[model samples]
Target chain A: MSEFQPKIVAFVCNWCTYAGADLTGTSRIKYSPNVRIVRFPCTGRIDYMLLTKAFASGADGIIVSGCHPNDCHYTSGNFYARRRWIVFKKLCDFMGIDTRRIVFSWVSAAEGSKWADIVNTTNEEIIKLGPYDSYHKLSTQDILE
Target chain B: MEEIKKIARELLAENKVQVVLGFEKGTANKVRPAFFTKAEDIDKLIYNEACIHNIALYLKKDTCQHAKGVAITATPNVVRSILQLSAENQITEEKIHIIGITHEGKCAGILDFKAAEEFSKTQPKGLKPEDKALIEKIQAMSLEERFDYWVEAFSPCIKCYACRASCPMCYCGKCNVETNNPQWIPVASHKYGNVEWHMMRAMHLAGRCINCGECNRSCPVDIPLNILSYMLSDFVLDEFDSEAGLNSVFTSALSAYTVVDKENFIK
Candidate 1:
């Protein structure tokens, strides 16, 4: 049997990681094609539940990237996102969810190479972890459908 | 106990309280939510070990409008829940009266915030082992897996709203799900609608739920509604080290913030 290829969902800020990804494309930097990016106005707008939805949709890994701290377009959106992620991360840890499956990163619009590196590194980590069959097992029947 | 019944009867007879929202025996010796509006109905009020419903949730309903104030049996969790409800403006602090019972079956008096906080301190921590287990099970799932798990858990919901009706915190006259202008959730009973409704309800209760476990117990489909509330409650507790119902002066978790609050992932 062939090994499963993990699906990764990258939720990137429109002003930052999204532009960085565009830069990655413009520069023709080669990286694993595992991630499907979803652009949000800011990381603050990304409800933690969206991460859950991605996993429910069978994504093996999630990357939430936005501007660096104190660099939010909305002055403090990233600050709020950071606080929420702390609690969400603690919750994931307490529940024993594989922490590697979820990554929190800061990628500016100018950081195209950084975006490629993140994708490649996260893809390699998740691929080594194997296909997220445990996710399929955990997702409810209705959500899986 | 007979003493509780006697006091309830006197309160009704003398009109000291307009109503006593206590427990009456169900058809087969079970306990159900009861309203003791008249002296005669006082005899029907029972305070046994099986009395579990919070009854505080009913304080804001139209059915309670006629009453001058409410008097109800209180478990420790009920005290916390009532305080949280009062803090949230679901019910005014003065409109309801409390009749607390000790673990040894002795009745106590109405508690103000000061009294409740003091009383709460005397009572040991309320988080039970089962609460931790339920939370751990939820926390263990990946984000998508958690969503799928909740969708399945809420699949059996028949839109009874027994959970909302039973929750002390769910007293919005125009609930987001019930409103039509900007309907946040559909009013159907399908798995998707039910899951969305429950998820929204849990999120709304985020920091306000006192974990009375009444919603789950009241659900006809036996969905573990407490697990949903506990998931958010655990987050509120661990991150903020804050307890709901402890202070009426402050805002809830999502509503209030600190300048130094964590925001490591925002852009």
Candidate 2:
């Protein structure tokens, strides 16, 4: 009867966003509980398949966060990731997927406040969008039936 | 084209090469690739203005293993496709021979391994007038509009996989689309499946496609499938200034990296 809380999958780069989330914990920063953080070495390591996988696994929103430009641990990893994300965003748009469900952000290892703010803002946006109905339709529930 | 066939037959009769790969007339004037194993079969090999399909797709098949060498009718895109395949280890340089053809239907010459290597390097200076016009047209559109335009153009796809089947660079035995354990793509021909099929194929070929136009030519529904692949290939070429099928020396665009590559999209 009531609105459902959206599930958010946040793929945070281990060297930057994950550390920033750690810092957020240490700083006692408050944020939405909707997001589940999955860490990667760098955003460049995130496969386009994994983004779709998260949605297929019932995440209403997905966030891919990494170090700010000129701050990648692998020097050019974020640059490669940036170029790939541009194509991925365009592909998502063309697929008729709601682009707002997938968010790309740069949260530095020191940006604990920014990480908390991003999580809260993204969570609020997802809540308004409701459950990811399109992705859910591709779930195992349909396969089982 | 007739002169080229006569020379091919002579070479095969002399046992200079074991196989001659060329086009034969097909239904509705479509040119389908024909393999000539015996010198007598060489009479069937034909080429004309309509020989557009990249016949390189058949060189790596199981049937080609017994052949001493492959002789293909070459266009610029066909040459480019071969170079890319050789570089990727799909076929060896020594296993193939190229018979280059001018647009005017003359056999430029038979380019063996060594000559093919040099020919790719001698890529003509300055962009073709058609390429310049295409680039200008593409550049005039907004990114969102371009995305929308491609989606409409790709709507005719039927998931036949003919495009994938005919591509030289698409040599994987177990393609991503066919994986079933955790199916990467739907098996049906819905709009979502069709769009995803094209997008996934285009993405996989981002840095590898050589603008051969084989995928577009092979499409049954006449989708401008090459535009997506060509756009990505152009992006990779401009960003890294690397040519995909020209030589084996340069690292693939997606596989290798530079510390100075652009990162404007990252916040």
Off by over 4 Å in 1: A1-6, A15-33, A90-99, A109-112, A137-145, B1-18, B65-68, B129-165, B170-206, B219-235, B259-267
Superposition error at B30 for model 2 (Å) = 4.0
Q: What is the TM-score of candidate 1?
A: 0.73
DockQ of each: 0.15, 0.24
Give candidate 2's error at residue B49 in angstroms. Answer: 1.1
How high is the lDDT of residue B170 in model 2?
89
Candidate 1: tens digits of C-alpha lDDT, residues A1-145: 2276779999988887898899999999998888999999998899876776677568899999998766778877777777667766654554344567898899988899999999988888888888776544545553445
Winner by TM-score: 2
Question: Could you tell me which 10 consecutive residues in candidate 1 chain B have the lowest summed lDDT?
Answer: B258-267
Write one digit per residue (lDDT tens) for candidate 1, span B131-240. 78877777666766775666567778888898888888887777776776645565667665565566667767777888888888888999987766677777787777
